[model samples]
Target: MSPQTKSKQRVRDHGEVFTAEREVKAMCDLVKDECDRIDSRFLEPACGNGNFLAEILTRKLATVKKLYKSNPYDYERYAVLAVTSIYGVEILADNAEECRKRLFALWDKEYTAVCKKSANDETREAVRYILSKNILCGNALTLMCVDENQKDTDKPIVFPEWSLLGTKLKRRDFRLDVMLKANDKPKNGQPSLFDVPEEIRKYLSINPVTKEFMAEPICEYPPVHYRKVQENG
Candidate 1:
């Protein structure tokens, strides 16, 4: 690519940026408060440019600094500790890579300043693993298929290529007992489909009635249910 073409190749062409100074500060403040409140892990499903994540790291360092005021040598480990506890997911590979770099940069900045030393190979590897597992390059809207019938649509739906470091989801795991029981009951049951959950009723009442309890488009099978996916994911 020529310099001229590169100049025209813009980041905005890919996706919209959602960062604002006030919003970033508020996110950091929330992380600080939460760290104080429970001292637990955090996750970001769509960490675009690491703005929110960077702020999170900063707040975590500040909180840890105050927590271990007397013994500050551990701040380097604290910075890494904070970052390792954080997870992120980004759709774009380049953006995901960028987010990882920014995260490491922030961690290194704090680590070096506090410890007066550079990150070792071990630390770098840890950061890389964290990026590979947590900052995935996949679509959050992805749905799990129960059978071979379910597949991507004929019309290509471009989604992130990244895979999460978690257990795969399945239909049976959702435990939709009421829905399944309603499905199992014969139409002889007293009331009509209307008595079932709104979702079940809606699925049953599509204009072109489907013979199967669940309908699958010819090309795409095992239709995705967003609510189920989120719960399982």
Candidate 2:
């Protein structure tokens, strides 16, 4: 692993400190089952260089290999699903890019070794596209995308909810701020966010079963074959 701090200045400026590998392992062990599930979703709000996410992906891939090693088609699909389940937000653009490259390298190495003759470029590119969407350069606390200088942008951070339906993948984009707001209720005597003006309230949806207010996706794409998401989704 790289040193915990790139420089003293970075530490002071951004409170950046990379977690050691041993500690990352121990913390993940606390939710070991989730880490092993290929489609289980995980988000690291302050994922500096992806120390924790890397380990979780490694474990999920291992489980995929164990179950699908004999069948290349199954292995490729599940491995891509594993990659799609991981997400992160890093305040620094450089760190966010590094985290994405690091994850892709780790996944590609295992994929190449296992699928060997069966691996194809289309599936690999699909994984790349998923990572591009799943990881973001942003401030998790403010839930806004960040600029190169780490200033919050006027644009709110948006993330796609990716789900697989057999060989097809479905996507829905949600604003981070709206998602957080939907998860909580207004405190006593406070106004409900859904009670806003009609223009903004249009973004909220109701769960038919639970009868609860939920954040409506800003946009959604029809399910497309996993290999064609980047091109057609």
Candidate 3:
């Protein structure tokens, strides 16, 4: 069994049980193809210390290293995308913080080895920002993220959707609840969840990063740098 829980009381109160490494790998293998895809999105609603997310990040980074080993520019972009694509919700404050740290460390290890002297501070900061947004401290069941104090906030859990547009990175924020409702349809003749007005859809379809289509992000981070660091290169 994975020795991940903080205490027996936590397990009893939260029903928290960390999955063993072997089992995590076995289960993720069922979706091996997706796991290997560098840009595939994954959400762990009840992530505890990021057992699943960590493995997923490792696999995606491996693909980045394999395909873009020679191109630091492409490697940096895709690696950031890989980190941005993972989402996790842990109710416990400590667990959420630990998960973020663990994931960052995992990424940094591979990044340092591959990029060597070329590592850029700005790029690393961007990754840290992305991880901060991706793994949240909140009640997944209630879809509410907590503040730094660990108190529930009125705001719903929000996540930024990242995309590479030519040489630029585009970000759009969306509510977790709204995204979850994407599949639902009302019986009455009404707009489906996430439906945009026809007039707005025209603009969104062409340029999704427009102000009209984008929602304000609940959290803020340093701007992302798209250029590759040339120190090691």
**Best-performing candidate as measured by lDDT:** 2
Score every model by TM-score: 0.52, 0.92, 0.80
Answer with 1 or 3, whichever has the higher TM-score.
3
lDDT of 1 by residue, 1-233 (tens): 33212233344453435577687787667646764421356656667767777677667777776675445444544544566556665555666788888888877666556555443555555555545545655443442111222232222221211222222212221112232333564464334555566533543432234332432221222322211223222
State how far residue 77 of model 1 sits from its true place (Å). 3.3
By lDDT, highest first, what's the ranking? Answer: 2, 3, 1
Q: Report the lDDT tens digits of candidate 3 across residue range 1-233.
A: 34866678888888888998999999999999999998899999989899999999999999999999898777777887788789999988889999999999999888888887787777887778778878988888878887766578887787777766655556666677656543334335343324654422332321133312222343333333444311211
> 1-233 in candidate 2: lDDT tens per residue?
24898988899899898998999999999999999999999989999998998999999999999999999988998898899899999999999999999999999999999999999899889988988899999999988899999999987788889888998888999887777766666456343554654644667765666655688999999999888889754
* Residue 60 lDDT, candidate 3, scale 0-100: 95
Better of 1 and 2 by TM-score: 2
Residue-level error in angstroms, candidate 3, position 126: 0.7
Q: Give per-residue lDDT, candidate 1, residue 187.
A: 62
TM-score order of candidates, top first: 2, 3, 1
In model 3, how large is the Cα lDDT of residue 194? 47
Any runs in candidate 3 off by more than 4 Å, and if so which? 147-151, 188-224, 227-233
- Candidate 2 lDDT score relative to the true structure: 0.87
